[model samples]
Target: MSDNQQPAKNHVTLLLLSVMLLGAALVFAVAADAPHTLVLTAAGLGLSFSRRTPLSRTTRSYVYAGVSVLAATVLQDQIFPVDTQRFYLIDGRYYAPAVIFLGIAITFFEQRDTTLTSVISLALIGTMIAGNSGATIVTNPRFPMTNGLLDYFHFFYGCVVAVQMLAMLAVLPHVDRRVRLPAPGRAWRWHRATVFWVSVFGVAGTVVGLRVAAIHYERLADRTFRDLFRVYMRRQSERMIFGYEVDLWRTVPPRTRADKTPVVRALAAQAPGYLRGRAFVRYGRGTWSSSDTGEHLPPTRPGGRYAYSVFRRALAGRTPSATPPPAPRPATIDLLPATAYPLGGLLAPGNAVEFELIADGLNNSNEGALVPREWDVAGGYSLALDDSIRDTAYQGPAEPPTEAERYLDIPGHIKEDVARVANTVFGATPPRPGTQGRLAQLSRFFEAGFTYELGVKFDPAGKDPILQFVEQRRGHCELFAATTVLLLRAQGIPARYVTGFVCGERPPSGTYWVARLEDAHAWTEAYVAEENRWVLVENTPASGFPTTDSASGVVSRAFDRLLVAWQNLLAQVKRGYVAEVIVALFLGLCRGLGRLLTHPLWGPVAVLSLGSAVWWLWQRRRRRRLAAADRLLVPTRTELQKTLGVLEKQARRFGVERQPCNTIRELARRLESAAQGPLRDALLELLREYETLRYQGTPPAVEAVAEFKAKVRRRLAAPG
Candidate 1:
């Protein structure tokens, strides 16, 4: 390759590497939600290669800038379709393309003059901020300051600034060095001015265009763009389905084909049967809604007497005299990693008397939901619960109160159909006139008649879902539970729909149960007025419950165990418990060593040994130093004499041999006169330094003596 072409090639290579690194970082960071990051990265590489084409520098900069803006505009329309009402600017998928294309554009212009590049960079930053704002406002009704806008701004700007700075640092050093020439005429200056203004205007136009496109796409560029940007927001309750919509009216469950997706990794001394989650008391057209609006109970302080009293009262029930009921039994529940939402799940059946431990921000409780004030938390807590109460009929008043009215809510349309089914199954005259008998009969009826199947599809425009499930005799756990709840409510037995995970395989460790996504289930919780507490009634057939039998191979089980270990590690990190343990162990070891060393006999022996070792080390280091100094001092004498002899022989060829009676400095002057040039100067300096070091008590520095010797050797070796 030619000399000129090599550096240019290197510059392009470096630029490409930087761009790729930046692109890869972005892709991996957000690719799970936004795959288009890869496409933009590839396009950026293509633009970088085109820099080799025969085009003016100015023209190339403009071309790249224009292409970048066009790419951003196109991507905005493609990723954010007009039909979607909600736009999550925080979603990397929405803003990745714009950032990638603009970054590439900034890199291209970075090789140009400072003023133009700076302007382009500023324009890019402004464009990004404006586009983000426009997209945020269009998709969300809230003002700019709310919902993590400040954090988003800091993050977005930080990324843009970092990428731009990296690109500039990579390319600026390789900019072509222009030869000094006469100043250009006024017309040339004017042409330059015009190009600058044009670039400015072009960037402004692109920014405006991007904002417009993001706010509302006039026409989608292609079907891929349309499909790629299509927004499908899943409700928070559908997390078990892994972001897929779970239409209540649909026959098939949303997430039926199961792989091993862990729902909870728990370790306890005993198996906690089920971890219950959100419950809905109202049912309408196959949908379940919770409308209890229960008062939020403040979390009791951990160790206070008031806290203990509250827990004691809740667990013991209203004691006639407050003679202090016996302490409740405590069970340790460890929530491993992989569990989502630290609070919303039933720890144990009875009232939680006291929490052994809890993660920060998890201090709120509702009727059946225990959640943190904030959404982000990872560890779990052990609690003391009164597990003595069995799931029996309530002995309280049979009359329903205003609070119980919500559980009896069934849609008017399905009321008659559900009541007819209930009467047919349990008999119209109440064989046993209590809630427990009716619940048991209903459960038995559904388990006998309905077949538990994961894959069942119903027509969108068909009969009521409950009616269809009853007639078809086939559905998943959701359908069975929904039907059971509706039937119970229709028969005036207050019931609610409950969602949670059933216990899965017991690991060989035999400590805790592992609950996977497939274990997620829905069941009916009938309110037993007699007991003043809800009782779980399993209406779903046995076939639907998850089992750890040989169907799941060794690999799946191993993966689950690995997940549990990983979660434990994360919990330790968050609580700093691992660090504390390490520190404690280190201190303990130090204390033990100190105690051992303080013994009179061992202490004297140790001191003597340590002193002997220190003395030996000092002697050894002193010997090495003396040896090094001797080598430095002795080598100079022999090497200098040999070098002078070589120089004398070379001088003899010029008939200027040194005399033994003459001083070295005097001899050097004679040699210089014979061979007058750089060779003469080197010989003089070398001889003068040699005389000073040989005679004077003060020896020259090791480096100076070595340098003088090298000069003498070079002069001698030259062609005479």
Candidate 2:
């Protein structure tokens, strides 16, 4: 590696290492959604290909041309790490092409620190690769992420960069000492010519990329790629410039993001019951108001002691059973953000008997309302619920309210319509005594034809909104609860509406249920005359009531994982982790891109196409300019003019040139004076042929001009 004599081998190794390093950063950048990968890629490619001479320069340039493209894929995990559009501003369509041109502009300097250039390029490339997928990517329950350290793609790249740095400690040994036509001057000219030709092909590549990208994204946007060519540029700008193509994502329908935003994080010994927020006693005009519940307010000084009273009243006059009751499930909940609702919620598990909030900072309203003092607080409210405490066969309240007009009344106007719904939902199935019977009935009604949609709107002046709900069978949680209350009340059953969150989402890796805005729900709670209890009734379709079922083994495993996650969080919080995390992310990006460029099919075709285009264009530019001497006026008017200009420019180089005379006779006199013998006779013959073709439009063989240029070059070089 320290041997300067091995330039060819060294260049090959550097190319491989450079591509690998760049590929890793690019992949990680895309995964992390860092947008600046575009700028770094263009600059890196431009700086790397600054070789001189037509053939070697173009070949070297092509080595870097298609390096920006590798593999085309849409990442499967629906995570987008880009928080802002700052990356897009820098990697704009205009900025990308400009960067390429500017990179070529950098090649205007020949004796550059290739080592420093590679280092800076890789460093910025590393930066654009940016942040880690977060620690979660490594330990996520999904195993695909950390497989084979594919996420560590640039380890090989880093090793090479380090080795090259060691060599840079030896840079002074490599400078050439030639005096006349010094190596630096020759290098300057060579570098200029190299970039000029690279620019030509770059422009062509840009035009072709743009045209193809437009056609593909516009006309073929909806269709399949059909071939590899179509997808080679997936997530990249048309080959014109290498930037992330935001619109090239596969057309998979996105998962609904409406409710993924979490509003609460609650931990439980098991999935806790529906956390109750508010309870409403009166129902009319399609609304449930939490007023006049006919119950005394519970005391609050002793934190959770007052809550047990609310539960005891519900369990009033209950009888104990022969079976042993299950232990109380304990849980804590925190409000993640301030919400429209007045309070967070009270934990209410199935058949909760003696409810107690171990933590305070919250208040309870007797009608099942638990209001939090602050939206986001360090301390969360904890409570216990006895899921196994059945209604225990209650036989109605000891002394029912004696008033003829109960304030907790359902409106009489909607009784007939609700009864009709009852007939349809129950279908002659005789009602059983306890709270479970009514709960089962309402559950069936919701499941029959109604859907759990959040978009169903209602008009206040319409013909009985509850009636309309039954007829149309479309409403949200509110309507579902109201309809259930009305239906239960129509059958002479006492029921009220309850609003709260249905916190039942238990992840495999978590001991908690996350509640989001979409989880805010409303349901019915009916007082069982025979059971003497207010039991929860889930009336919304698919909103099944909570159940307490968790094996000890599963709970233990989840607790262990939670502990590990907490420790990981602590590790990440330390200051030293910032650098390590940044490096890890860069490696991951490079690894991903490395996979793409190393693809068996896409990689080779890209390299070949780029090489061929550059090679052909360099040759063509050389032919047209006759650059061995210099380029003269470009003949666009006619064939005679084109041939004459070529001949005149070449003849002038040997100091025997003559041109621009209007008459053929006068031109002949001048050429005869400027030269003599074979050169003069040959020039006159060519002039006569040009005159013939200019006026007569008599087409001459295409070879006449080529044969003329060959003769002129050969004679001009004959020891003049």
Candidate 3:
């Protein structure tokens, strides 16, 4: 390998290979109906990693996976429709997101921008997007159009993955060479090992890493995620908020993100007050969890506006009193929930028993919390209640007085911050009387200095998100609610965490109030012994609530309604195969096997046939291995030409297709991807020699050519 012995092909060929792989992947993703999210994930990660930050292929792959999940999964509302409006912002100016997105992608398409870092960013990021997006487009309600379509889809995805792996493998060596000096001085054995290991895990790792990447792309490309980059402006106003659950503690690799997909619709003339969802009795660390000790009411269809079920006084923790009847307004709306089980239940501004409520089924906790049964929770449900009031008490189980202590308890680690905030807000004032007075007192915390913001991230560098939020005086509803709960608990007011939607908007044509994911919120519910029941307390600043313009845009609302309608259509189309043909075939095969075994007459023949098939496979594999070994030992007619053919066949077998335009150098690189160890390095050296001689316009002497071919044969025969 002389310095002047240049390879015939250049980076252009590699560029074409990389682009082909990317295009193939995107084609499959888009055809699978997952292009929007997959493209967003790739563009977002690629744009970020393409900046001058130094990172490795392996490191980039892992980072892409982790950050994509965090940004796209836990906070889907904030991340999706990355561009909702016709225009997106750039340096405070508006531009079409599609133009900007496509522009950048094309810029990187050419290998002119290719570097060790940039190329890996493209390859690895593309892979994560393709695998994750494709996974989402083909699951659950997405039954195959015909029998075995899912299996065929999976096979297609596998082929696309194979293409990506082959391209990356081919480009990896050049990427390695561009970043390192050819020779290194021999040092201590340990030091040599360090250098060897530090060559970015050397060539062998590409194979291992190829399999390791795309491990969790499915999460980022969540089925519910909407990459509304086209809706950039609409996306701009969308913010991350709490989902259906009352989750307090921060999560790691969250189980799910906030979904904007329409889950349920409440059709009513007026909006439901705080559609009370989940109520948590216990709080620890930074999380809130539920202790659901209640009863499951079977589906009840009572006569004359039949109430689906009733919330007994025992569950409300209320002694019989002059509880006002729910305002008579029965409305119907089908729920299109996000999960298998809709976590939170509706509160239609009615007394515990006033409004009739039932899904396919309902679960009532002793504390008045409700959830739909495991699966059948969609379609229409009926409820009657007044929509005038926004403030409502969330109740819990009635039991031993000691049980109330749990609400007053605060995580010991944050007791200091809690005390500080309580003092700042309450300021030694005498405890307020009744639930209203307590709520008035709690509202002071929001007034004191805090500000409501949606684009907030947890700050782990200083104190926990609790104190940091107080010190900084800025965050979303979750922060406002969590801090308010902590403030009240510090003063001995029994408070529990609550989460649900604040429904307000009605669709253009429909009477029902539509509660989009952005409206998801958190508020504190405190128990006042004097009131004999829990009462709602909204401590979030007024700014936290959606504005008329923000929440009730006619176009945005229309688009949302249409999107929901479309989603509902897809979910209910149900035109695919009614039964799993694969399962039926399996069962039939099982029955045949059983009959054959039981008959005893045919059992021996079956076993013999199985044995013969296995033996045939083994023999075929052995023969291939033997033929491979023999070829490596003997050189064919032409010097170097025979070796190239063998290498080409090996490369093709590994899914590395060669173009007719490929030069010998391009062929060698592709072959190197399928070959490894001494065989790979030997190919590189032999190619260099042939190029050097060809450049000089002189053929190598017969003896030298013979010796060169023999040397290559020896290297091929050598074990890795």
Top-TM-score structure, candidate number: 1
Instruction: Please report the candidate that would top lDDT against the real structure.
Output: 1
Q: Which stretches of candidate 3 lie over 4 Å from their true place?
A: 1-263, 301-361, 384-391, 400-403, 429-435, 547-720
Tell me which residue pairs clash in candidate 1: 337-567, 394-530, 394-531, 395-530, 395-531, 396-530
Assess the local accuracy of residue 277 in candidate 1 as a C-alpha lDDT between 0 and 100.
61
TM-score of each: 0.49, 0.35, 0.40
- Encode model 3's per-residue lDDT on 15-92: one tens digit a residue: 534454355435333433334444654555355435432233355655554454433332222222121111112210
Q: What is the C-alpha RMSD of each candidate to the true structure, in Å?
A: 15.7, 25.0, 23.6
Order of models, best TM-score first: 1, 3, 2
Which of 2 and 3 is ahead in TM-score? 3
* lDDT of model 2 at position 483: 76
| Each prediction's whole-model lDDT (CA) | 0.54, 0.47, 0.52
Please list the residue runs of candidate 1 whose C-alpha ends up more than 4 Å from where it truly belongs after superposition: 1-247, 253-259, 297-330, 337-367, 380-384, 391-403, 430-433, 457-463, 508-512, 530-532, 548-551, 579-720
Error of 3 at 614 (Å): 71
Error of 2 at 520 (Å): 1.6
Number of clashing residue pairs, candidate 1: 6
Candidate 2, residues 1-720: lDDT per residue as tens digits? 111112332343334334534544444443344335434554555455544311223445444432322100101111111222322213222232222223333332233346335433543344333322332233222324434443543443334334433333333233332433335577787876676556555655665676578666964654553454457544233322111111111121322564454445565555554666566665556445554233432434422112112123343435565657555455333222222222434434433433323232444344545443322221233344444455312222334422213324656786666677777765646644445665686676678777655445555567677776777786666677777777776666766666666676666666556555556666777665554455566666653232222222576556645643553333222212333455568888889767757889877876787689999999887665444222332232244555677656645544654532246566666666664556556666666766665445444555664565565556545523
Residue 627 shift from truth in candidate 2, angstroms? 72
